[model samples]
Target: MADEIKPAAQQQVQIPVDVSNRETVYANFVQAHLNADEVYLELGQFSQVVTPTGPDPIVLSHRVIMNFVTAKRLADLLRRAVSQHEQMFGVVEVDPNRRLRVQQPPV
Candidate 1:
Protein backbone atom coordinates (compact mmCIF):
# COMPACT_ATOMS: atom_id res chain seq x y z
CA MET A 1 0.00 0.00 0.00
CA ALA A 2 1.25 3.53 -0.84
CA ASP A 3 1.82 5.87 2.07
CA GLU A 4 -0.35 8.97 2.26
CA ILE A 5 1.22 12.42 2.56
CA LYS A 6 -0.19 15.11 4.81
CA PRO A 7 -0.78 18.68 3.58
CA ALA A 8 1.86 21.31 4.47
CA ALA A 9 -0.44 23.16 6.84
CA GLN A 10 -1.55 19.93 8.53
CA GLN A 11 2.02 18.61 8.79
CA GLN A 12 3.57 21.72 10.32
CA VAL A 13 2.39 24.37 12.74
CA GLN A 14 3.86 27.80 13.52
CA ILE A 15 3.14 29.21 16.94
CA PRO A 16 3.38 32.93 17.61
CA VAL A 17 5.00 33.73 20.98
CA ASP A 18 5.27 37.09 22.72
CA VAL A 19 7.68 37.61 25.62
CA SER A 20 7.87 41.35 26.00
CA ASN A 21 7.34 41.35 29.76
CA ARG A 22 8.61 37.89 30.62
CA GLU A 23 10.63 37.56 33.82
CA THR A 24 13.85 35.60 34.10
CA VAL A 25 14.98 33.94 37.31
CA TYR A 26 18.13 32.14 38.33
CA ALA A 27 17.91 29.23 40.76
CA ASN A 28 20.74 27.31 42.35
CA PHE A 29 18.52 24.85 44.15
CA VAL A 30 15.32 23.08 43.17
CA GLN A 31 12.92 20.81 45.03
CA ALA A 32 10.17 18.80 43.37
CA HIS A 33 6.76 17.95 44.73
CA LEU A 34 4.47 15.67 42.74
CA ASN A 35 0.77 15.04 43.19
CA ALA A 36 -1.84 13.17 41.18
CA ASP A 37 -2.45 16.03 38.78
CA GLU A 38 0.45 18.47 38.92
CA VAL A 39 4.09 18.94 39.84
CA TYR A 40 5.45 21.75 42.00
CA LEU A 41 9.00 22.94 41.51
CA GLU A 42 10.44 25.04 44.30
CA LEU A 43 13.31 27.03 42.89
CA GLY A 44 15.72 28.73 45.26
CA GLN A 45 19.23 29.91 46.02
CA PHE A 46 21.38 27.72 48.28
CA SER A 47 24.09 29.04 50.53
CA GLN A 48 26.33 27.09 52.89
CA VAL A 49 26.71 28.48 56.39
CA VAL A 50 29.35 27.17 58.71
CA THR A 51 27.97 26.51 62.18
CA PRO A 52 29.41 24.80 65.24
CA THR A 53 26.57 22.28 65.18
CA GLY A 54 25.61 20.25 62.05
CA PRO A 55 24.92 20.42 58.32
CA ASP A 56 23.75 23.64 56.69
CA PRO A 57 20.06 24.16 55.98
CA ILE A 58 18.65 24.91 52.52
CA VAL A 59 16.24 27.79 52.18
CA LEU A 60 13.74 28.02 49.35
CA SER A 61 13.03 31.37 47.75
CA HIS A 62 10.80 30.77 44.72
CA ARG A 63 8.41 28.22 43.28
CA VAL A 64 6.87 27.24 39.96
CA ILE A 65 3.89 24.96 39.50
CA MET A 66 3.42 22.93 36.33
CA ASN A 67 1.27 20.06 35.23
CA PHE A 68 2.58 16.47 35.09
CA VAL A 69 2.71 16.47 31.31
CA THR A 70 4.62 19.74 31.22
CA ALA A 71 7.01 18.52 33.89
CA LYS A 72 7.70 15.36 31.87
CA ARG A 73 8.35 17.39 28.72
CA LEU A 74 10.66 19.74 30.62
CA ALA A 75 12.56 16.78 32.05
CA ASP A 76 13.03 15.25 28.62
CA LEU A 77 14.11 18.57 27.10
CA LEU A 78 16.58 19.26 29.92
CA ARG A 79 18.02 15.75 29.62
CA ARG A 80 18.64 16.19 25.93
CA ALA A 81 20.14 19.68 26.37
CA VAL A 82 22.42 18.48 29.16
CA SER A 83 23.56 15.51 27.08
CA GLN A 84 24.39 17.75 24.16
CA HIS A 85 26.20 20.22 26.43
CA GLU A 86 28.29 17.43 27.97
CA GLN A 87 29.23 16.20 24.54
CA MET A 88 30.37 19.64 23.45
CA PHE A 89 31.95 20.82 26.72
CA GLY A 90 32.24 18.42 29.67
CA VAL A 91 30.05 16.59 32.15
CA VAL A 92 28.39 18.69 34.81
CA GLU A 93 29.17 17.28 38.26
CA VAL A 94 26.76 17.93 41.10
CA ASP A 95 28.97 16.80 43.96
CA PRO A 96 31.27 19.57 45.21
CA ASN A 97 34.28 17.34 45.85
CA ARG A 98 33.86 15.43 42.60
CA ARG A 99 33.39 18.66 40.69
CA LEU A 100 36.66 20.07 42.02
CA ARG A 101 38.49 16.95 40.88
CA VAL A 102 36.90 17.02 37.48
CA GLN A 103 37.84 20.67 36.98
CA GLN A 104 41.52 20.11 37.84
CA PRO A 105 44.07 20.08 35.06
CA PRO A 106 45.60 16.70 34.21
CA VAL A 107 49.28 16.17 34.90
Candidate 2:
Protein backbone atom coordinates (compact mmCIF):
# COMPACT_ATOMS: atom_id res chain seq x y z
CA MET A 1 0.00 0.00 0.00
CA ALA A 2 1.27 3.50 -0.94
CA ASP A 3 1.16 6.37 1.55
CA GLU A 4 -0.91 9.44 0.63
CA ILE A 5 0.86 12.78 0.03
CA LYS A 6 -0.26 15.63 2.26
CA PRO A 7 -1.09 19.10 0.99
CA ALA A 8 1.23 22.08 1.64
CA ALA A 9 -1.16 23.47 4.26
CA GLN A 10 -1.06 20.20 6.15
CA GLN A 11 2.74 19.88 5.94
CA GLN A 12 5.00 21.84 8.28
CA VAL A 13 8.15 23.33 6.79
CA GLN A 14 10.86 24.83 8.97
CA ILE A 15 12.77 27.68 7.33
CA PRO A 16 16.03 28.79 8.90
CA VAL A 17 17.11 32.42 8.93
CA ASP A 18 20.79 33.27 9.51
CA VAL A 19 21.73 36.71 10.79
CA SER A 20 25.23 36.04 12.08
CA ASN A 21 26.98 38.84 10.22
CA ARG A 22 23.96 40.90 9.29
CA GLU A 23 24.49 44.50 8.28
CA THR A 24 21.99 47.16 9.37
CA VAL A 25 21.37 50.28 7.30
CA TYR A 26 19.32 53.39 8.04
CA ALA A 27 17.59 54.76 4.94
CA ASN A 28 15.27 57.76 4.78
CA PHE A 29 14.84 57.48 1.00
CA VAL A 30 13.97 54.35 -0.94
CA GLN A 31 13.79 54.06 -4.73
CA ALA A 32 12.43 50.93 -6.33
CA HIS A 33 13.00 49.80 -9.94
CA LEU A 34 10.87 46.91 -11.03
CA ASN A 35 10.97 44.68 -14.09
CA ALA A 36 8.84 41.76 -15.15
CA ASP A 37 10.35 39.31 -12.65
CA GLU A 38 12.54 41.18 -10.14
CA VAL A 39 12.67 44.41 -8.14
CA TYR A 40 15.74 46.54 -7.45
CA LEU A 41 15.63 48.70 -4.36
CA GLU A 42 18.03 51.54 -3.60
CA LEU A 43 18.08 52.61 0.04
CA GLY A 44 19.69 55.91 0.93
CA GLN A 45 19.60 59.20 2.84
CA PHE A 46 18.85 62.65 1.41
CA SER A 47 20.92 65.64 2.49
CA GLN A 48 19.11 69.00 2.47
CA VAL A 49 20.98 71.87 0.84
CA VAL A 50 21.62 75.16 2.63
CA THR A 51 19.64 76.98 -0.05
CA PRO A 52 16.35 75.70 -1.43
CA THR A 53 17.37 76.07 -5.04
CA GLY A 54 17.08 72.53 -6.24
CA PRO A 55 16.42 68.98 -5.06
CA ASP A 56 18.36 67.39 -2.22
CA PRO A 57 21.23 65.00 -2.94
CA ILE A 58 20.56 61.34 -2.20
CA VAL A 59 23.51 59.27 -0.96
CA LEU A 60 22.87 55.59 -1.50
CA SER A 61 23.74 53.41 1.48
CA HIS A 62 22.58 50.01 0.36
CA ARG A 63 20.95 48.15 -2.50
CA VAL A 64 18.57 45.22 -2.23
CA ILE A 65 17.47 42.95 -5.07
CA MET A 66 14.56 40.60 -4.65
CA ASN A 67 12.06 38.65 -6.71
CA PHE A 68 8.49 39.85 -7.33
CA VAL A 69 7.15 37.42 -4.76
CA THR A 70 9.43 38.72 -2.02
CA ALA A 71 8.78 42.31 -2.99
CA LYS A 72 5.01 41.77 -2.80
CA ARG A 73 5.38 40.16 0.61
CA LEU A 74 7.45 43.08 1.83
CA ALA A 75 4.87 45.56 0.50
CA ASP A 76 2.07 43.76 2.33
CA LEU A 77 4.07 43.70 5.56
CA LEU A 78 4.90 47.41 5.30
CA ARG A 79 1.25 48.30 4.60
CA ARG A 80 0.09 46.37 7.66
CA ALA A 81 2.78 47.89 9.86
CA VAL A 82 2.07 51.45 8.71
CA SER A 83 -1.67 50.98 9.23
CA GLN A 84 -1.09 49.76 12.76
CA HIS A 85 1.22 52.70 13.49
CA GLU A 86 -1.30 55.24 12.18
CA GLN A 87 -4.05 53.64 14.27
CA MET A 88 -1.90 53.83 17.38
CA PHE A 89 -0.69 57.39 16.91
CA GLY A 90 -1.82 59.48 13.94
CA VAL A 91 -1.58 59.72 10.17
CA VAL A 92 1.87 60.42 8.73
CA GLU A 93 1.99 62.83 5.80
CA VAL A 94 4.92 63.31 3.44
CA ASP A 95 4.12 66.90 2.54
CA PRO A 96 7.27 68.85 1.66
CA ASN A 97 5.50 72.16 2.34
CA ARG A 98 5.15 71.31 6.02
CA ARG A 99 8.92 70.95 6.44
CA LEU A 100 9.64 73.92 4.22
CA ARG A 101 7.56 76.22 6.42
CA VAL A 102 9.55 75.17 9.47
CA GLN A 103 12.90 75.80 7.75
CA GLN A 104 11.91 79.11 6.15
CA PRO A 105 11.78 82.41 8.03
CA PRO A 106 8.56 84.35 8.68
CA VAL A 107 7.43 86.44 5.74
Question: Which one is best on lDDT?
Answer: 2
State how far residue 24 of model 1 sits from its true place (Å): 1.3
Write candidate 1's Cα lDDT for 1-107 as tens digits: 99998766645668999999898877888989888998999987766676789657777877889998888899999999999999999888888888777355789
Ten contiguous residues with the weakest lDDT in model 2? 97-106
Clashing pairs in 1: none
| Cα lDDT listed for each candidate | 0.84, 0.86
Residue range 15-95, candidate 2, lDDT tens digits: 999999999888889999988889999999987665567877789989899998999899999999999999998776679
Q: In order, how many clashes per candidate?
A: 0, 0
Score residue 27 of candidate 1 by CA lDDT: 81
Distance (Å) between predicted and true CA of 69, model 2?
Answer: 0.7
Question: Evaluated with TM-score, which candidate comes out highest?
Answer: 2
Q: Model 1 Cα displacement at 50 (Å)?
A: 3.0
